[model samples]
Target: MRGVEHSIQLVPDYRVHHQAPYRLSILEATELKRHLEELLRLGFIKPSNSPWGAPVLFARKADGTLRLCIDYRGLNRYTVKNSYPMPRADELFDRLEDNRFFTKINLRSGYHQIRVATEDQPKTAFRSRFGHYEFTVMPFGLTNAPATFQTTMNNIFRDILEEYILVYLDDILVYSRTLEDHIRHLRDVLQRLRKHDFYAKLSKCRFAQRKVNFLEHHVSDQGLHMDDAKISAIAECPVPTSAKQLRSFLGLTSYYTNFIQGYARYSYVLTSTLLRKNPPWFWTPLCEDAFRALKKAVTCAPVLRLPDFDCPFIVTTDASDFAVGAVLSQGKGVYQFTNKYGANVDGYSPIYTPDEWSATGDTYAAGTQGLLLWAVTLGALLLGGALLIFNTSALS
Candidate 1:
């Protein structure tokens, strides 16, 4: 990504590189005038006296396809960072875990679908070696381009995201196992695209596939595997140089926190101490312990199933001065192994009580007895309620 010049250097034989036909239809003279007027309103292309100013420049995609590029290089450097989250590669991968069937759709020059507002367009204008050009739609590298695209996607997927579909801007993935449901999902996505007047690069879309590449990662029914290149990058993450580095590592580790048994306790040392303005860059024993524990936790992390919110809330909790940890388990007939070191000498296991555990070596026994007392009380209440309901139903 480096060594790419900040300036636009022309290829003398621009036509050779820009040979491919634009996938979109070229504007007729009247339409061109209308577009130019639109750009004037949007402020992307201004009226300039320079003979070479604000003419469109076209370039070929790798597949010999022409893309309309507004050379906004000079202007982009001054732009402010847009407030939007780029799609997290990990989060996207995690979403496709149980998806057996998938469809991938790529937009035909995704940014071209959007028309920059009249006043905002001129700020996007840039000078190239040959001439000045401005974007009819949003351009790449603009600080706001990502935010704009994300907003566009969020609006488009407002309805579909509630179901079994996910949209990442130009990429729309529809997933299902059953053929009937899969067909319906695919139709729904395609219909939405048509309604929006968005063009897709059909050559890039995959329909009803068992596996697919999504946001640079390969996903299948088996689950997502780290991209080979990305695995090396993660492995080569440098050791913490400062608090920022420590935080970065901790943040990355936190993404997989569900897998760790006591992540809060493990991360307590670093997260608690680093907030001071002049935090020492010392790798103390506790910090090193936390660092090692997090790495181990990542490898041994449990595979948690997606929660079923309708079911009963079953929670396991343990507390310490350093941190309190809890797992909210919803499904019936779930198993949680108690830590032997934290268990009671009496061989009785507790259901939920963090404070008692810390106070007693036999917390398992103590918690279990308390749980029994609570359960008996709950059972009596439930029995009375059931009898009352039965009497009411009989009377009705």
Candidate 2:
């Protein structure tokens, strides 16, 4: 955040938007005023006379706290996007490599730690019922904020990143195989934070945990497991009354697709209706059955053991005229991949037919018979792309 200022590059002849502030309720007004005072005290923001302005509003959090936010849709339209890539969660998991100990560090007001590039600070000015103000540091909702923040974190931890530390923006996870090693790694991470003048919220930080909940997955030496809270939500969910509701359920379930075999298969009937421009609203018996089956599958999801490259992998795959399904296993399932916020969907593509994904059914096509039983070793394998590693001479 200090070494690199977040730059907000705009496209040519961008239309400057200075929208009027939205009316606030009594509670919102109180919260906004309080936040503005705090931001001013911290020197994170200042009174502005900039021509470019956006509206300020309050966004409700899950815990019901009102978060002061700016509507940046108008400004973002003209802003050039920062497409800096983030490390995938799946690749991060692979690096865990059966580490038995874990420590997670959550930074305090992560984005606020970063300064917006001097020239772009004026462009970040937003108008509120109280007054017009501009941010000195990067504020939430900017188009390039994520990329900027991610770049900052990567640069801060570049030397030790992926050795024992994995960073996703403000979340720094230091993992090690033993308590002794973990202690040293933790110190190193803390020293780095201290060196860079970054601060962590001690209350939100976990130390020497064998199991850690991160990126929506419960990560441990046993690979990634489904989060119980999310599973319970899936279990208690009422049947969907609309397409939007159903898609929400699917999105939640899809995040843990690694733990659920035949996920795409079980979810097909439920998802097919959503593909059409105008999907049928009826909750048919088949859809209900599929829904129940999916819930049951998620609740009973298995622990995806970390893949061992030394072990021989069992590549179980099947295909029908319309669909193909595959499971990468080493006795237990070992799936991989994650971005900052989402899992890779390609590995869990929707199954077109039911029986096509069945693991026990005859895997052969109705009219074909050349069954291949090639060894697929390593965690590097992709679903459709032929993947994996090991000396090919061993097969010979």
Candidate 3:
């Protein structure tokens, strides 16, 4: 109760009825009793006769222990959502450009550390075989739980947010350009947590590491990169034999679309299968080639460099009747963006008006008898083009 504050207020008019208790196995009953006893001892919950009640459920943890949870779906429907803003992952990653030292800290049972509003406590009541109970501290599965916690953390560390530390919910990342500076920053954050009586799980914390994984992506002084384990999973995935399986495959690969060049074009044929409404799934040769090409592209995806605003950027573009592709580069590092194959789609056309192309920079277009030249000269520009004219008989 050290950092507890009663701040959550549900809508005044909405009310929820009690849900009946769910049946539990003998072992599950015993486990529930044990957990309830511990919560009672800690003064986190108390016996209640509130009008509202939710069923209790047990979820298995990673360490092979059962975690007692409440079915909050009934109560959540009536609760007003909190619209507090949370930091974007991309913006957080963009701030780590020159940091050489890093430390990550995770708060212990983060949501439970906060207290529910006094008037709303009865609204969180849950039922089991023994009796009805209500939580004194905030519990998991609440609709606005994350927003509330994030607001609390932000208020606590508002002074040093972007300067020395970045917090996303319970995850605290301390970053610095030097080891000496990093130690001071870490100490400041720890002292603030101590002042608020917040505790961190030391076993889950990493201190003074040059490279650390944050927000599911690996980060270092070098730059940000996709997780190797995720890449391996994509490479090892077997060919899909059913519609459901094909959808799963596409979903997994699409997560890393930023890492792959021409991703949309490569997955175009595979996605067309999903649009068809017939019984039979047509696995054509074109689809097979696209699938194999995508897998190969992921395996050889380039390491994206962190952008430097002070340096000039190079934009290279190519357009054919089928597709359009572009690469934005600075020095030897590059990031590519491509549109799916189709000429009628907006911004996919090979021809662009001077005004349309001039937004990027100066526009330069030159043409000869049989060749068309469309170019934009960036600093130290390099332009190349190739045309492959083929006969219909050869393809047949």
Please name the candidate that would achieve the greatest lDDT relative to the true structure.
Answer: 2
lDDT, candidate 1, 1-396, per-residue tens: 111111222334332111221233343333444655665686545543222222245665546655545444444444455566766543454355345888888988776567666445545455433334455466666556667776777777777773667777677778887778899988988887787787899899898998777665556775543344543443456668798887778776654454456666667666667745887777888877777776665564433443222334343444444333444333333344443136311222112222111222333223434443333343342123232110000010
Per-candidate Cα lDDT values, in order, are: 0.53, 0.74, 0.70
Please report, as a residue range, the 10-residue window in candidate 2 with the lowest summed lDDT: 348-357
Regions of model 2 farther than 4 Å from truth: 23-25, 320-322, 332-396
What local lDDT score does residue 96 receive in model 1, on the 0 to 100 scale? 55
All candidates' TM-scores? Answer: 0.53, 0.82, 0.72
lDDT of 3 by residue, 1-396 (tens): 365564556678876768899999898899999989988998889999999899998998746888888999888887889899999765676577678898989989888788888888998899999899998888998888888889889988999997978899899999999999999999999999999988899987999998877776667876767778778878888887777888778787776665666666676667755545754887788878888888887787655555454544444444432333444345433333232232122221111111112112223322221112332422122222322121111010
RMSD of 1: 14.8
> What would you estimate as the lDDT of candidate 3?
0.70
Query: Candidate 2 on 1-396: residue-level lDDT in tens?
Result: 467788888899998899988999999999999999999999999999999999988888756899888899998999988889988877777678669999989999999888888999999999998899999999999988889888888887889988999999888899999899999999988988888878999998989999998777888886778788899989988998888898889888877776675676667777666545796688889989989999998897766666565555444444433334445555333333222123232332121111223233444433222223322222234233434322211111
Q: After superposition, which runs of candidate 3 have C-alpha atoms over 4 Å from their true positions?
A: 1-6, 21-38, 57-69, 129-131, 232-252, 275-299, 316-328, 332-396
Clashes of each: 10, 4, 0
